[model samples]
Target: KVDQSVVLAGVKMKNPVVVASGTFGFGREYGQFYNLNELGGICCKGLTLHRREGNPSPRIAETPMGILNSVGLQNPGVDAFIAEELPELRTHDLAIIANISGNTPEEYGIMCEKLSAAGVDMIEVNISCPNVKAGGLAYGTKPELAAEVTRMAKAHSTVPVMVKLSPNVTDITEIARAVADAGADALSLINTLRGMRIDVNTHRPILKMNTGGLSGPAVLPVAVRMVWEVANAVDLPILGMGGVAKGADAAQLMLAGASAVAVGTACFADPYAPVKVRDELAALAEMQGISKVSDFTGAVKPW
Candidate 1:
């Protein structure tokens, strides 16, 4: 039998296939389709200090090979998640990760502290959120800002902190190094790339925000490249994600140095995406005669 376990920042996961945050809404909606415990882990929807109504309608627009979303992190406040959602999530045996977004560094620290005290397995700091304080430039776009947020978050949380990097930056590896140096225990990348679409006849943008994050099979290459670069740049473990839709895609990411893989857009297309990726990874590992999944980490051979 193959061992698909993955140890991310000292947390042992049953497998290396975690459902990406924002894609899986606390696992309640998908739980009706299948058992949530079968996957490696679940990163719940992005949480904020207060509940948000999210952006206006038409927040989602379908692209050629992906979808653009300006959902704007609509979620019940963190307090509600702890009181109502976390309990239902605890019923599952998989690792529970809380993904938090903030408009300021202080909010990030506060959320981290709350999640730590709440007994969450890990806290993923979403630095990619457009900084409301900085005129909308995302914190993850700048290495210094990313590092500062990571440090603030790490100082407040006792649980392991993972910094989720945005792909909209000039050099993602630079931001990755910054977070790693700021004491981030682990990393997850890359967030959706910024994109836009215009209505041909209306001569207007498709999304209400005029622009949104693009996620799907189209971003796979970019994700793989960034993961490979960051894997070589930082000592922290990485939860590679972007456009994972199948087992083969997950395997490609693993070979490129992803300690684990997260499914996002694929889940939107199919609820069973995460479980299927895990199952496919197991079969591939067995075929390769590998017993442990971690063996694939940084296993890629250079040309």
Candidate 2:
């Protein structure tokens, strides 16, 4: 077997395959399908300072090879997560990366402070969730806002902090480097592309929110490119995402410089997406004579 163990920001994951936030639903919906412990770790659903009921109905609308959502960071609040979800999650024997979001830098710090004291392995600071306006675009679309939020989270977070980025920015790599320089231990990208679907008959957006984050196979290529760009911009490790749905897809990201990857929309296509990706990566590593997946990170041949 290849040396697949790659640590991102101090937390050791058996491999790079992880369940992306929002898609895996805090590992609850997938429990009936597979052993949650079998996976590397889960970037749980976005957690806000307070519990959110989520956006209106029709939050998810399927497309040709992608999905759109405006779910709005719904969660049981941090305390509930600690009291109920975290306790059960702890029993599962896997890294628990709490993904937190906030409307302001102060709120983000407070949330990170709460999770840090909980001893979570890592905190994925969600700075870009385009489905909502207040907290979503405020940090993601601006380099300064991104860095401010990232620095604030890192200041209060004892655990390593990961900044989740959006793809809507004009220059993604610039923002990525800014966040990294702001004290982010690592970064994960590219969050869903800013997209919308329209119901021609009704002349309105298909999603109840009218606009949503687009994720799936359609966005994989862009994600791969962003991974390479971000890798070239910063020395810290990176976790890439977008529309990875196969072993080769994961391999491609690795080759492009992803230290690890998080599976989001792809999970909607297959409950065992991460497992299959892991197996696929294992096979690819053996075939390519890669001793460790990290060896392939940023190995993209020049064009």
Candidate 3:
């Protein structure tokens, strides 16, 4: 059998297919569908300082080739996650990556410190989250703000930090370089691009939040491009994600320069996407005469 195991930022994973945060729901919900241990890692739903009720009705809107959502980082708070979720999640025998978001740098540090103490395999800092201190501007949209959050998380977390980048930025490479320079051990790219939907009849915005993050097949090309750009710009390992719905899509991201690929909206459509992706990736690697899946990373040729 081909070796699918990979070492990302010092953490050994069984494979390079991770379930994106927000889609997996602490691993328990999806565990009912399949064996959670069959995949590389699970990035738990985005966590916050306190419980969030999320936005009002119609938080999600369907687009032609994608969906838009403004879930507002809804979660049961970090304390509860650590108290109740972590113990059960540990039973899965897979790398558990905590994805944390904050309104300020201090909040990010606090969450990272707690997750690190809890012994998570890694911490994925969601810098795409809005910084309340900066008037609701996403931290990842600015290179300086992204670097600041990366510094804070790296300082407080004992585990390796992977700064998740926002595709809404003018120059993603600049942000990637900033975060890498700020001591981020890894990176995850192309968080949902900003988008919206409107009601032609009522002449109003369809979603309550009006603006939402877009994800699905439509963003795959953008994700690959951004992953390639960031990969070329930084030496950090990348957890590339955008619109990965199949094993071929995962392979495309890996070839573009992702050490691993995270399944986001695909899970909503196919609960077994993580396992299927893992299997498909292995099949593709063998078909390509590759024994080690890591060999596919950044294998894209310009010629």
Off by over 4 Å in 2: none
RMSD of each: 1.5, 1.2, 1.6
Top candidate (lDDT): 1
Weakest 10 consecutive residues, lDDT, candidate 3? 129-138
Q: Which stretches of candidate 1 lie over 4 Å from their true place?
A: 130-137
Residue range 1-303, candidate 2, lDDT tens digits: 798788888889888889999888878767876899777788888898889998998888899989988888878998888777777777786778999888899999999999989868899988789877778878988899999999899889999999988888888888988898899998988888878899999998888988888899999999998898888888988888888888889888888888888888878778898989988888898998888876777888997
Which residue runs of candidate 3 sit more than 4 Å off their true CA positions?
A: 130-137
TM-score of 1: 0.97
TM, every model: 0.97, 0.97, 0.96
Q: Give one digit per residue, the lDDT tens place, for model 3 in 234-281.
A: 899999999998889999999999998999898888888878888999
Worst 10 residues of 2 by lDDT: 85-94
Clash number for every model? 0, 1, 0
Better of 2 and 3 by lDDT: 3
In candidate 2, residue 219 scores what lDDT?
95
